[model samples]
Target: RAGLRFITCHEAFASAYSDGTAVRVTTDPERTQAEFARCSAADCEGWRSLVAIYRRIAPHVLPFTNMPLPSGAAAFHALRMAAGLRGAMLDLRHVIFGSSGQLVDRFFRTDAAKGAVLPWGFHQDFGPAVKGGAAFAFVAALSAHMKGLVVAQGGADAIVSALRRLIEDGGGTIRTATQATEVLVEGGRAVGVRTSTGDVLSASRAVIANVTPPLLFGQLLPAHSVPDRVRKRAMAFRYGPGVFMVHLALSRPLAWKAGDDLHRFMYVHLNGKPDEIAGTYAQCTTGLLPSRPVIVVSQPTHADPSRAWAGCAAMRLQVRAVPAIIAGDAAGTIRGRGWADIKDAFADRIIGQLEEHAPGARDVILARHVMSPEDFERENSNLIGGDCVSGSHHLDQNYLRRPFPGWTRYRTPVERLFMIGASTWPGGGVNAASGYLVAQDLLGQASKKAPQRGIER
Candidate 1:
């Protein structure tokens, strides 16, 4: 483990565009209304109302700042308050099933709606079962508006570099390209690990696996070592959805038809009405790729110019809520061809969609790299089915029930074996809550066993 230093950048701007009109989201609450005024006068009032609801509910939903999220009764109470319902019990299931579209519909008139529901879909890792929520979705959007969109100075790789430095400086050795074959269990305890390269590394304290539940229980450990019930639960672990990423080295920045102000934002969501998002989710669940998938167009080079060439820029385009395996194509252009067979065709469709908002996006591309769900799975075994979050964040798969119930504290049935990462509580994103919690628990246990040293007593 390493003690890493982080350099933070401000989330200065973000935007959501639909029907050629863009609503700018800023960190400054006062500027938000003015910014929305640039998009539409009718929607300005709706935006204001949405922000008001966010202010009221955000505090209740995210009660703690620098601590682990509260669970059980306290979590239930917070969720109820966040939902703005008095006397009614609101659980995560209610939130997940409840329509965020309904909440948006209440705040914004049909004509005034500019895809406000889109942010919730993207923010909550929108999937078939995830309908978004009044409390969860609103809080996610509000947090972004309040905190602004922040990124590392030199891109995400900068954080990895800093962590690597910390590890090396602390005399920790890192081995790459070594596949862990089995978790060596001795006397009903996780003692060490055996690698495919015929090397056995022993753990003095514990062995923590930052892997998906299936791999951790099914592959990394002997079949006879794990309990049947635990193995069955792991096998039943459900993945949310996969993402298709296209990284481009643009000859120049995107020229939005709306205005140059679009270049200031870190992310621009290209979505339509709330119903469109719901349709996409439905398609994904049924194993069909949406004809018009939600595209999260990120201009990282706009935030940190150092990432690209002197006169060019770098961009990342993400298509979310797509199936990992190809069952059918909603567009009907590439049916049952599989990701390997239709990855390029799918990328073309994605590029065409981008061109709708940012014209000449295809012409400006100097180079492009595409990663389909299949590619993602090959790159990281833990990303089962290319699910970016490792597992679903649905009601049954989140929080204390994550990776399966009764193992919330990162402990396994086998002593000294622990689990962490996206599959655990505080699921997904750049936040390292899972790792931090596990480290604290391990440290506390270690301190308890330390030999006392008092002068001569």
Candidate 2:
């Protein structure tokens, strides 16, 4: 195992959500229900029932989190899921196929209660109105309630540092600033890589590409080496809504109108009501900037103060459902044609909304950094058009059909060439399922060949 250290999060709250009024979702189920009860007694009961149902189906669904689907595990999960559906016929349909909005509607009556859980549905590129979003929403809320929020002590770079140590300690070399221009092939098999520096580094076993489909197909693997159908599908791979990021170095901590207790939670979502959120999704997908953006404000310093200077806070605002290309502004305030021309103006709108929740928040800002869709692409080519998730997680583009239909097992058309990353199955986030599954598979294949080669470990 790769050794990584994590800081203990706040004991009280997992996150806070607000439409106009705020609701703090506590780590304790009893306390969370109490918060829901403030909305309505029915919501409190609904929350309890939802939790019980999630516990039933989570065992069936969570296995696929760390493993690829369509395997024995997937088949077994399907059988269990089918059984669950039979037991909770009415509720399970909403859990699986209904939009997140509809799923919450079944349980919650007030906007505050619905707003708290609805934002989880937008964890990916999808909106709360999209079908299959309920699955994501349910899983995210359950995970938060069960495990609270976990953060690396020094930030994500700490995890990367640990991985770097692991790789180097295992006698692996990592070359920075080196671009892999081509995957060298020989006799219908991947052999190595040709880098931008005109150096060809040979691989003894396989070449794993942790990149997008477009970069993998015609760009890295030459057209002659790949089948036409595979190449076409890869070329046609769809990217979802672009994401925009704003980092604020606050001179003082944010003062939430809800209370000082709100500062304890790592995430605070400025999620309007369900219907408003649906409209925001509609605006962004159609290439228009939403009048009111759904914002997730992450306060890392709340969990780990080491991330910022003494007495200061480092806040990151994540805005999703943004257009890859700007066509117009729903507010009709900006006249810019592209993200570059309008990012600052758009960021201002985001900051204005933040000010409404936490007054004097803008006054405390010591410094600010904004990354538009174009900026994200420049930072990482895999984030095409600033689509932080790489590819859409829509049912058509996910699971068995991820990256494309013929290439779900991480194996490509060229033998010994493999693909893994956010673009592959079990898609996105920090879960390294694709990497682990591919490694296990390669090891299995190696074990089978070891007997023939007269090799011993």
Point out the worst 10-residue segment of candidate 1 by lDDT. Answer: 1-10
Candidate 2: tens digits of C-alpha lDDT, residues 314-399: 99998977998899999999888789889999999999988888889989999999999999999888999899988998777887
Tell me which residue pairs clash in candidate 1: 11-149
Backbone collisions counted per model: 1, 0
In terms of lDDT, the poorest run of 10 residues in model 2 is: 11-20
The C-alpha stretches of model 2 lying farther than 4 A from their native spots are 1-3, 8-20, 80-86, 89-93, 451-457
lDDT against the true structure, per candidate, is: 0.74, 0.84
